[model samples]
Target: MLKHLKEKKDVGFFTSIAGLMNSCSVLDLDAFERTQKAEGLGVGSEGTAGEKNMHDADFTCALFRFLQLLCEGHNLEFQNYLRTQAGNTTTVNVVISTVDYLLRLQESIMDFYWHYSSKEVIDQPGKDNFCRAITVAKQVFNTLTEFIQGPCSLNQQALAHSRLWDAVGGFLFLFAHMQDKLSKNSSQLDLLKELLQLQQEMVIMMLSMLEGNVMNGTIGKQMVDTLVESASNVELILRFFDMFLKLKELTSSSSFQEIDSKNSGWITPKDFQKAMEQQKIYNPDEITFLMSCCEPNMDDLIDYREFTERFHNPAKDIGFNLAVLLTNLSEHMPNDPRLQRFLETASSVLNYFEQFLGRIEIMGEQKEIFADFHSK
Candidate 1:
């Protein structure tokens, strides 16, 4: 049954189903707001205000779960087909509209956080509302992650067409705002964790687009510029930087472990090169540069542990130093989470600046702008 679904002829069938799903999933924001007011805030004395269901959580989740199954697989054939279908039948709108709705709903949930204080006990209805929001958001992000893991070219083109760059910016803003709100309460770890996961997934998706040849030209530069500017918020910048470092560490360690079959903490330079190459993260020159940073022993083996530690340590990173200098963040010690966030934000800002410089083909006006900033 799954095999037949992957066939070219069946693409139209799935595309039509997606289109219908999208049309039916259109959210009535006003009605949604009213429902939240009645159920979450107890705005009206009687329950008559939310008698009509504005959003069907069960139905929506079930529908998306069905689509999620079709998109999930070891291969991307069916997902690609559904995504590439022409005209109104394409699945891109379905994904984008769902994302738009989910982000807005989550924003409302964040607003709901203001109603109760950490010192005060949350009422039954408030508790239920918060739980409901988390469930729906998890479903949306889980389904969307599957939907996005497909051919980069098709996904990148759809990204531009759907104006996802704008959505990405909006999401970053919402994330930062939510983080600020949650920091006050500090009890909603579940929702905060989910947001963190979503942030990482969104960044990974954008990295996929940038890593692919699809976004390597002018449009790519523009998109990168937009993202860099959008991530200017300090909270968002720290989150992105922390996620980036964690991801890099995970991938690099996995690669290193694969090459160190003997479970030793050391490997030859040739093995190091092979492992790095397999990750597809670093270019040849970058790999060579990393290799140069390591001091091989007389046996000519690299200390993988020491090398990784040195790579992750931000003490000497220019961005980290600049951040410390600019923010005067001497109150917290090195291991403090507050100080860590400062370092992460600084590192990400530096990386974004470097990326902006490297991505532009012609120096032109952009170079002068960057140079002016540097000179200042």
Candidate 2:
């Protein structure tokens, strides 16, 4: 059956298979055990003529192979089926558990510290293994986000699911652990940045879920506790701020003066706009939001030092601070080597804090903008 499915080139066939897989009932382990005992079958036993001679391992391999085929050339159909299933409670739960499994497996094989260690002996095969693990991690994360944002949009049940929160926590922890591993590698940095954006989207969906649940008074205390615990990890927060401060250093140097003629240690909105355009990374909405956060005057000038002071303090609108960091990482020029390095490092840091604030805001804690700032 696996070989037949793999050889088939028809899109409809793949779609049908995907739909069937999605709609299938969950595995009945009790029935399977009963059947095994009745048949007196060993792990390698050949079944009767009417029944297929397959063990659990064979079934697992075939299932994965079918999924691989669906993913490889029939992604649209696969995604369509997933979209259809996104709203189903059972399907959402299955996706969450599957993603968690993949993440845990990847984590087991890819040693965060060892992968980045200078003293570790890393050959070509080892590097390939790291690449493969990161790719799997990315796939799992992307799948989770799609379920949250697409099929499961505003799905309170899915959002409140402990497995979903646990998977996200695991993802964030892995990202934090692997930060230093991607430092000197630009390609890996790009991948990391993409992962961060996906993480941000997932957080946004989770927040929407929280809002709905809060209004309905159905938000689980355990979910809230998980979010708060994940958000308040001090080491992660410090690491995030450390990269943020480093990225700020780039703006203080004389290089940016070439772009900002006023050079009054500040850049006006107009100037910032032009720089963003030159970099070909400008987004109007992001620029507007960033300008609002910095509180530019009639002259539209953004004072770097003042902006820094405002953004660095969590007490002053944690959401806005996150928006600033995200905007900076997204809009900064990647072609310029120095700026690219700074942006990549900033991206890694922003990744964690975005998740942090996203989780915290879900609990209704960090949404307000304060007039007075308290230094942390």
Candidate 3:
């Protein structure tokens, strides 16, 4: 029937299939299990001779195949139909809900396989069942990927017009979660390879959308805005770096030469903690977490080179530093009204500038504006 519909190329027939596909939503496994139990159809329940037996695995396989058929042909027509359906909130909800459900199902299967395969003695039947489960889960993932990527594959039209980024983000998050889960089990190397390939493809697609052709300034403007935002908080971050430099000087001085002799420019956690306390900067908890993240091996020493590297390449430790700063700022708010007001005003002004930049970036022929702005 699907092939016939495909061959006929009837709009209504394909639209109906796309609508059905969009209607697919994530299943509530817990509720489903509860209902199954109420109906005397538990996970491993079997019917007597001459009676019909229903299994969750069977139902899952059937659903998987159905979805696979919906996405089998790189069906651009169906994808276009879905793009139209996306205008309806209910349809979008259904699509997202379904994707979420499939991701959860895939995660559950991977978790089960990882757990069972790690055991010393694995049941043959159980392992086979899990292998089949993994296959079904992969099918579910591929079906969704094909559906989302099919339209976006046509240059960047679908990417610009549809909520492709949202879909990409959702799938990326799920894939990351799956990757983490599989990382623990050494047996899932093949799955990990496939996941890495998918991640690379998704990232390339996202870059294509952002960068586009040579004439496109979207990515350049985005980079500029990011730089501006990062610079906005530079003063606070610089103060932290300055404190680090001061501490480095203190620890490297003759007074602490004995301690420095052991690690040759690396300072012990105790010394680092004391320095932070002297600076009255980070709290005890923040200091502890920072020490752990920086050291990571309980080596009892923080490398001076490594510490400075984080400043040069701020991406490495910026999140931790920002989080610590925010926590400290919040703690001091009650006692430091003036500091709070100053921060609030600065944040407001920076936000206004960000909005202004966004508007300027969106304007056509921004070259003249940029040239004029830069000349001033």
What tens digits encode model 2's per-residue C-alpha lDDT throughout 1-376?
A: 4335334533454455445434322222334334456555554534431132112323333443444444443244353443334333333233444444554544443353343456323333334434444444444444444444322323345445546666556655655544434432434544444444444444444443333232213333443344345653424533444533433444554555686666677777676556544543334653443444454657766676665553344322333343443333223222334433333544644543554443222222244321211112
Global lDDT of each model? 0.50, 0.43, 0.42
lDDT of 1 by residue, 1-376 (tens): 5456444445556655555455433223345457666656666634532233224666667766776686776246555554554433333445555555655655566465544435344444454555555555556655665665543345445655665565566666756655444432324444545555555555544444433232125334544445456545544545433433442454357556677777788889888778778776655765664665556789999777765654344312323333323222221122334444444546554553343232222232223211111211
Give candidate 3 regions above 4 Å deviation. Answer: 1-9, 23-27, 31-155, 187-194, 197-201, 204-376
Shift of residue 85 alpha carbon in model 3, Å: 12
> TM-score for model 1?
0.49
> By TM-score, how accurate is candidate 2?
0.39
What lDDT would candidate 3 get against the real structure? 0.42
Clashing pairs in 2: none
Residue 50 error, candidate 3, Å: 24
Looking at model 2, which ten-residue stretch has the lowest summed lDDT?
A: 367-376
Ten contiguous residues with the weakest lDDT in model 3: 367-376
- Which numbered prediction scores highest in lDDT against the true structure? 1
TM-score of each: 0.49, 0.39, 0.32
